[model samples]
Each structure stands twice: as C-alpha cells, then as structure tokens.
Target: MKVLIIGLGSIAKKHIAAINKLDQSAEIYALRSNPHSKSDIAGVIDTYNLNDVKVSELDFVLISNPTSEHFSTLQQLVEFDIPLFIEKPLFSKINEETQSLVDEFEKKEITTYVACNLRFLDCIKELKTILKDAKINEVSVYCGSYLPNWRPGVDFRTVYSANKEMGGGVHIDLIHELDYVYWLFGNPDKTNSFFSNTSSLKISAYDYANYLWTYKTFSASIVLNYFRKESKRSIEVVTDKGTYYVDLLKNTIEFNNKCIFASQKRIADTYYNQIEFFVKNILIGREKFNTIKEANTILKLCMKD
Candidate 1:
C-alpha cells in the first residue's frame, strides 16, 4: 500500500513506526511544513512539498498536522477524494460550515477516519468485549500529566499542546476521551463541565477539563489535564453486575467484586489491530471495523461542544 504522511511530528513518527512494524512493504512518503535538519529519518526517505505532491497516486493521505490547521489542510485534500486518517479533533473550532465539508466527503464516497489513538487501546477494546452482553450503567476515565514532561526536548509553551488556537489544551487535545466515551455511550445532552488553565505553567489554553455527563440511562465523568507530577491513563466501567477497571499501560483489566475476588488479563498491543482493520476494509468490500460517519459525528461534538 502507498501512503503519504503529512506533518512529520510526534504522532506522525508513531504512525510511521506502527505502520512499518505492521507491514514493512507499505510504501510510505512523508511531508512536513518544517523539516528538521538534524532529524535522524531526514535523509533516508523523501519528503514532498504540498504544492508538488500528487495526491491521487497515494492510496492513503494521513494528516497529522496541528488541529487548527486541519481544516485548511483538509481543504487541499478534499479535492482529491482520497481516503484519509485525520488526527483527532476535526477542527479546533466547529461551525455549520465545517459540517458541510464532512457532508461533502461522505457524498463523494471519500473515507476519512479520525486518529483517536485511545480507540486503538487494548484496554478499551476488551472493555467493549466485556460489556457486549452486560448492561453498562456508567463509564469514567482519568487522564492527565505535566505538559513539559510530555516531550523529551521541547518547551511546553512552544509545543502545539499549549496553544488553544492551535487546538492545544485538555478540552480539545485529550478530547478523544469525549469522542470515544460517546462511542461507548450515546450522544451527551445534559452536560456540565469545569475546565480551566489554573497553573502559571502557561495560561494560553485550558489545561484542565472535568466533564460530568448525564446520559439518558447512564452517567459519566472524565478528569483530563496537562498538570500533575505523575503520568496516568485509566478507565473504569460500572455495570449493574460488576465494575471493570482497565490500566492501559500495564495492559491489564481487573474485575473487582466489592474489591475482593478479582480476575485480570494482560493485553497485547492493538496498534496494528486498528491498522489492519482499516486496511482490510479498504482492500475488500467487507464491513469496516470502525465507521467514518461515527467518527465525523464525534469529531463534530469535540469541535463544536
């Protein structure tokens, strides 16, 4: 498969790494607005300019650009009617007009999948399996950490995660939680939230967002942030029968019976799982493992709400 990766940043690197690991022969070309002269992968592969690159030849166009720039970059892409993997939030801010673009993509039979990496987490995939028969009443998640600690070399202030206009911040950045939570639950209407950039760390964008979601039959809350001493990512699902706890990094799921008897399972990586599912759907006429319509809908809520 031939693929063109845009914005050779962190996620782009991870995507390349994940793709190569999955399929060594997947012809990969990368593009970035600003290429680092000292970067290791700089010389080994060819990088193309947006103006020069022919979009139709590429089987997939993966846009890993900053959120705010997504719409404009998408503008350049929409004309080609090719499959795309757009990273997270459809746009920094959503409007009626943006919906039109999404509608057009669908009308033209262009498939677009939002890259919500958490959706590819082993824990969540199993949680979905466990809840397949059980009746789920609620779901909650906790994800937060220091922004400066996120990257090994860059300053937090200059990184895309710190700029609200660039779709940086807990609300937009960690918003995959919101998107996927809706995927697990349904649409959220009774929503109350408390989010702000409290620390002097850099008050450009909201660093924290705590959401209290009131579903029709269930309830949920998520505490997300770019502030903390330690890094953490966890999810808990409470059904009428029992509770399922997932420790993502540890790749373990512990079922607690009043905090007494329990069972746990360690999960293998699901990164390639998500990629293979996508590739299969593209190659064959089989049903897609994930839907772009659903993704675009969640992206709507993330950008608008």
Candidate 2:
C-alpha cells in the first residue's frame, strides 16, 4: 500500500513510524512544507511539493500539517477524492472556506477519517464498555503540560502551537479532550467557555481554556492548559453509584475506588491501532470510522462559539 503523508512534523513522524511498524510492505512518502524538515523514518521517500507527485496514485493521504495549512492542503487534493486521515480540530478555526471543502468531500462521497487518537486509548475503550450499562452524572477531563516541555530543545514560541494564525492554542491543540467528550456523550445542549492567554509564555494564542457543556442526561467540564508544571491527563466520570476515575497517563481505570482495567500499552499503540482500524475498515466498505461530519461537530464545540 502507498501512503502519502503531508507534513513532516512530530505528529507526522509518529504516523509514519506507526504505519511502517504495522505494515512493513506499506510504502510511505512524506510531503513536507519546510524543505529542511527531517524524518527519522528510514528508506522513505520525500517531496517538497504536491505537484511533484501524483496524489491520486497513493492509496491514502494523511494530513498532519499545521492546523492553519490544513484547508489549503485539502483544497489542493479534494479533487482527487482520495481517502483522508485528517488531524484533529479540522483547522485552526472553522470558516466558510474550510466548511466548503468539507462539504465537497461529503458531496463526492470521499472516504475520510478524522484523527482523534485519544478515542483509541485502551483505558478509554474500557471505560466505554464499563459505562455501557452504568449511569453517569457528570464528567471532568483535563490535559495540561508545560509548553516548553512539549518538544525538547525547540523553542515553544517558534512552533505552530504558539501562533494563533497557525491554529496554535490549548483549545485547538488539546482538542482530543473535546473529541472524546463528544464521543462518549452526544453534543451538549449548552456550552459555556472561558479562554485567556494569561501565561508568561510568549504565544500569540490563548494558553488556557475551560469549558462547561451541559447535556440533557449529564454535564461535562473540560480543562486544557499549557502551563502545568507536571504533565497530567485524566478523566473523572461521575455516576449515581460512584465517580469513576481514569488516569489516562497511566492507562488505569478505577471504579468506586477499585482498579478495573490496567493497560500495558504504549502511547504509540493508539496511533497504530487507529491507523490499523482505518486501513482495515475504511479501505473496504465495511464501516466508516471518523467521518468529517462528526469531526466538524467536535470542532465547533472546541471553538465554543
């Protein structure tokens, strides 16, 4: 199988490594915006421009570029109607132009999957199973880390995450929390959000976001930030019986103070599993994994407009 990955950033490298490990036979080609971008993947092909190669010839395309460039990149390849695995948040911000491109994909019946790898986590999957018959009252999810600690040796301000135009912010960059909230429970009836850039970090975008989503059956609160000294990511699902605490960073699920599931899986396993499922299910007509429609809904919630 031939896979053309757009953008050679850190996330793109993870996809390449995961795909290659999953299927040694798969040929991986990278489309990088920066000519100087480096790839750790051995023996993989690289291209600076999309015109240099035939995008239609590839089996699938993975858009791992900066959020700001996603719309333009999709516009260039939408005509090909190739299956796409787009990164989360859709774009830095949703606008008429990007929405039109998504509409075109839907109208053409193009097969596409949005990347929200958090949904594939073992702990998350196990929580879904445990909550199948259980009742929930409220849920709280949080993901926070020091901006500079994200990528070692690289200035956090220089990366796309620090620039608002590039779709860099806790709201968009940490959209996995939003996606999973929508995944576990449907859209909220009402949304209240507070976003600000009070951090000392020299970023053009907001460094903090706190949102409250009220659903008919239950309520959810999400917290995202780039100022936490110690990295932490966890979820708390409250129910009529008891609150279920899930430590995502440790891959542990506890219900009523008892550990239920403990996953020994690595973080990369989520990417591997997501790509594997997408390839097996999306390639064939079996089922649609993460449709653009659903992604758009989550995107709007992240925007909290």
Listed per candidate, the RMSD to the true structure in angstroms reads 3.2, 1.6
Q: Give the Å shift of residue 23 in candidate 2.
A: 1.3
Among residues 3 or more apart in sequence or in different chains, the pairs in candidate 2 whose N, CA or C atoms overlap within 3 Å are: none
Model 2, span 1-305: residue lDDT tens: 89898877778878887888778988888887779876667967888878887877888999988788878888888888888889876877787877888899889988989998989999998888888888888899999999999899998888888888777899988999998888878788999999998788867888999999999888899999999999989999999999899998899999888998899985668999888888888776547766887798788888974
Runs in model 2 with CA error above 4 Å? 34-40
TM-score per candidate, chains pooled: 0.87, 0.95
- Deviation of model 1 at 150, angstroms: 0.2
Q: How many backbone overlaps does candidate 1 show?
A: 0
Report the Cα lDDT for residue 288, model 1: 47
lDDT of 2: 0.86
Clashes of each: 0, 0
